[model samples]
Target: MGYIILSIPVFFLLIGAELLWSAWTHRKVYTFPDLIANIGCGIGSQVVGAFTKAAIFGVYLWTYDHLRVFTLPANVLIWVITFLLVDLGYYWFHRLSHEVNFLWAAHIVHHQSEEYNLSVALRQSWWQGLFSFWFYLPIAVLGVHPVVILTVGALNTLYQFWIHTRAIGRMGWLEHVFNTPSHHRVHHGSDPKYLDRNHAGSLIIWDKLFGTFQPEEEEPVYGITTPLRSWDPVWANFHYWADLVALARRCTALGDKVRVFLKPPGWRPADLGGRERPKEHDRTNYLKYSTDAGANARRYVLVQFFLLLAVTSLFLFKQDSLPIWGAWVLAGIIVLWVMGLGLVLEGRRGALTLEAVRVLLFTGAGIAVWMSVLGWSWWCAVIIFLGAASMIHLTALSGEGEVAGQ
Candidate 1:
């Protein structure tokens, strides 16, 4: 977690560089709303992970203490071996997430974005850490320290972040060895041929060996086959599960109902619809999911998002010292912040009302923090000023129809 927090600056720098490169080349790969959704998912994942880590790590530690076959020393050679093993574990875990139904419920969030870029790399599923840790328990059993596995896993994750871009072309031989952007783009591709292919984490060797590899020939059409069609980050994470449960409810047989989760994605009982695979769509005709928002709304959302990002950053940095209840309170506020931004971006009917409420909540929080921490502070003044200005803008926009900025 510390490693990831430290890399935040680098992530922003590379994302900025990618934006510049895209503009300079006239090959735009990002949309404003999609980018916001991506970052929102990323922030949500980190906050959720912070709350879940202790329990997840506890399981790993228990497995290591009781189920170990042999303990390995923390040597350089062991580190190299553990890294490979962790990557291998990620390979299987990632593959299963796509092939299995329940797992896809968490992973689908990562593939919800229609555009692939550095921001897409940050788009992670908030619940994945809860289930994914089970896949790496074998390493703990093998006597590798849980901390070592965790650190190596973080490095594996950081390595994959750069591969989530179109700016970099295929590296000749490196593409054959490592998971480069070309390979990752294919993985994210919604085209039938690319579906469920290239499930490597940091190494392309797993894909090559396991026969999930596909070369990028035609340009890939990015996103899931059934588009999420909304910007709500929380809904993006849970919608698939809701769909699965609904399907199960429609089934009459107990076994079929159970299979709704056990079977691969797109599978259904014959009574429900049978297995209907997603057909490939023509790349030239592909359209991204979008919603119209006025200039004012867009500006408002961006400012609110950045402010929430700052609050989230502080929460992450001070999580150890903060009380558990306080941490959850902060997390709830951030979640509402993201949801309000999403609603505003989508130009939902009550978006202005939601944003107005969010502004009041933030203003109250600022006052509480100021009164509790210092008698008076410049930070409180800034928060209150921003909140007041946002409320005014939201009020003005309330007269606009469901679609703002349009």
Candidate 2:
């Protein structure tokens, strides 16, 4: 995670480059709300993961300790093989997330974006790590040290980040061996033909060998079959599970109720129309989810979003040294801050009031944590300034819609 924190600037640099590419090439590859939602989901995932990874990764370490068949030597050959094994593990996990119902609920947030760009790569479900770690336990039992698995796993993940872009075209021969942008774009597609097609991590061979590979033909219509219209990243993580729970309650048979989670996403009992299939998307008539925020509201959320990012990066960097209770409280505040700002962008009723409450609460919490760490200082004034400015903007936006520039 420390390495990921260090890599944060590079991620933003590439995203910024992509934005410039859009400007130069005249391609509308990003929208304001979608980009915010994407990164917000990512922030929540990291926050949640910081707390959850110990227990989840513990299982792998335990497996290696007790269940190992061979105490493998830490050699270059072993490192290379472990890297491939990690990729294979991720391939299976990624495929299962698409095929299975409960796993889909964990991974669906990644596909919620209608637009594909570098930021979309940041968009991930908070629950995905909890579900995915189970898939790698076999490698642990096979005697790959947990350290090897963890390091290579991070590299495999970082490799996929660059592939989540629109600026890059199809790589010629590399397309056959590796997961390129074209392959991943198809994975993000909701079109009937492209649904659940390419599920590769770094190597494309897994998909080719497993018979799930599909070449990019037409430009895909991105996102899931059922669109997640809301910008609230918190809701994006749980919405599918809520849908599954509602579906379970509707079933008459007890077994069918349990099957609601065990079955694939569109599956249903015979009484409830069997299963839903992906519609043949007519590209000409399709509409992406568009909930517009006024220009000023957009500007407000944009400013606050960056502030949240900076604080989130700091928290991730220092979480190990922070008190457990402080870490938990700060994590909750970040998640709520994301929700409040998302609601504001969605222009929902009472969103400004909620944002106001969030500003006051987080500001107070920030002061408490700061005073404890460094004793009272002028930094408290900076926090108060942000809170005051946020409140003032909320007041201005209370009545006005899109005012003149900031």
Candidate 3:
């Protein structure tokens, strides 16, 4: 519940920081659309994680139900030690999530955003929880209660959130001891030197002890080496999967195909090949193209930022009471918004229509929230329906933005 409560505010904080940085630097870059995408990623990942873990734990408890093997610990010191052990367990799991290729597939979604901010922290993987619990089973075997493990895990995750930003520079001596923003920034960096470095959670000692530590030099470059080409959540999550599959198909030798898939993004098969690959760049060049979506999409995202904020406000209000239907409505609106944003970013002519449709849909969300506050009936749903229909019509009639200084 604390995680859910803080998620929205954390998002806004990140947005505020991004805006301030842009203003200070005299650049107009906006990361609000990226924030919306991250919100989807975070909630989606947790929901998928919860269901997967529930099933796995159900089987574990059911199998152990008859063993008479468990007793909840009563001592306070032992519980504290157990919690610390859990953090240590997470240290290893988090480390492996970056080191192992198979695990990295799920972990990569969080690093997809080119801009590093609190929103990047929220960008999570839908598939991470499916396999991540295996790393924690040792705790269960050691007789630590699952409740204690969960509490520690939540704390470990919460502690890492503050480290995702450019607002705070290195923390002098604390840089050597704690997982500061500088250390985590290096972790997110695609700089050849920074790749696979600083893989710690809640403690920086692991990286120092493990020989993977690297201090932030000249402001770390964020995002994966190969930037994601689309804004769609499904594409964002599975783009690497698709890339792997295509690489596998291109390789005639099974071993080569498997190897290519596991190797870093730029690998290629020797005998069977495709077009010439693009040249790789020094990590320093990353920021140049970090938020460079096409023109139409930028406009669409600008509107989306405003519109989604309205929808998000409503979602927050009804979050506790309207879990089932409200979730779907919010999800549907978000999906369409991403689609529209992508189309505009790609310079599609139909984006004008999408823009119109989105405005109506957003207006409907606003009206629905207002009605709910005023104690209205199901007629409120009609606003969303009409808004959705208007969105479709708007998509059909929209055009390109007028040139500046006309």
Candidate 4:
């Protein structure tokens, strides 16, 4: 219920606004394929995880009906301790996801993109829920209420959002202990030495203690060793799985088969057999250069962000009965989906048509909000109708997001 209520329109609204603002800003180019694939994967994985969490919690509640485990203290100290421990649990799950092959398969999606943006945070793996939730079972077994776990998880996620940007540099001593943008950036790098390093989610201590730590030595190269190479969301989500499965089948020995899939990014089946393996070119500096398609896409994302803020505030003012807080929450989701669409269609010429439709719909919605605030009758209805029409048109144009003059 929380996922549906919080995710649906709210998610779309924030992401939509972000994309509009991103396009308008013209700072960097973003890819529609990257945007779309990332958002699709994010939503799919999150929704699936949400459902699994709820079902498991329900089962726990039924089994332990008499357990009175909501022992949250009245003091602020207890709350702080709980929050810190939740971060520790997340760190374990996150670090393990990097060390274990099956876990890495689910996590690699987030590191697949070359660009770093808020949307990149949404580029989650579809299979991550298959195992990540298991790490949290101990909390339930210890009788922490499911509601508390979910709330802390959401807070942990929200806290991570600010760390996903190049816009924020490192903070002196804080950089050494916290997972700041600089350290996190190194974690996402594809540079040979930087691979499988710095796997902190909310805290940096896990990486430090477990010796999975590597500081940002070189300016990192982002994305996977075997790039997904396509904007298709389905492909981005499953390509690694396919590669691992295929490599497993081709292995002559059972141990070699399992080892090949579980080894580091550049490892091959022949490595264990002392046979020659195919050489790969160094992509050390690939992400440094700028692409025209990338520039346009980033511009689109900037435009979406500002537009979301502007229009959402406008809507809140017009609908005086709606809470002010809800407007900001709505704005975040709109920005996310917009970035998602932009990434999914990157390098395709069809993005222009979608942009046109998005602009028209938003313009109409803005006007309607203004009209309602000015006491215009039936204006809100017109806005709704036009907004729906615009979205439908945009949906139709989405297929052509990679093509020009469509």
Residue 216 of model 4 has an lDDT of: 80
**lDDT value, candidate 4, whole model:** 0.61
Residue pairs in candidate 1 whose N, alpha carbon or C atoms collide under 3 angstroms: 294-404, 294-405
Better of 1 and 4 by TM-score: 1
Prediction 2 global C-alpha lDDT: 0.89
Clashing pairs for model 2 are none
Candidates sorted by TM-score, descending order? 2, 1, 3, 4
Best by lDDT: 2
State the lDDT at 379 in candidate 2: 93
User: Across residues 251-272, which tens digit of lDDT does each residue of candidate 3 receive?
Assistant: 8887976786466445666675
Would you list the rank order by lDDT, best first? 2, 1, 3, 4
Off by over 4 Å in 2: 401-406
Q: Candidate 4: where is the Cα deviation over 4 Å? A: 1-29, 59-78, 255-267, 270-406
Q: Residue-wise lDDT of candidate 4 within 193-228, one digit each (tens)?
A: 777778777778888988888888756767766666
Model 4 TM: 0.64
N/CA/C clash count, model 2: 0
Clashes of each: 2, 0, 7, 74
Worst 10 residues of 3 by lDDT: 397-406
CA lDDT of each prediction against the hidden true structure: 0.88, 0.89, 0.65, 0.61
Per-residue lDDT value at 131 in model 3: 60
Off by over 4 Å in 3: 5-7, 21-36, 46-79, 255-287, 290-333, 349-382, 385-397, 400-406
Instruction: Report each candidate's C-alpha RMSD, comma-separated, in the order given.
Output: 1.8, 2.2, 5.3, 8.5
lDDT accuracy of residue 206 in candidate 1:
98
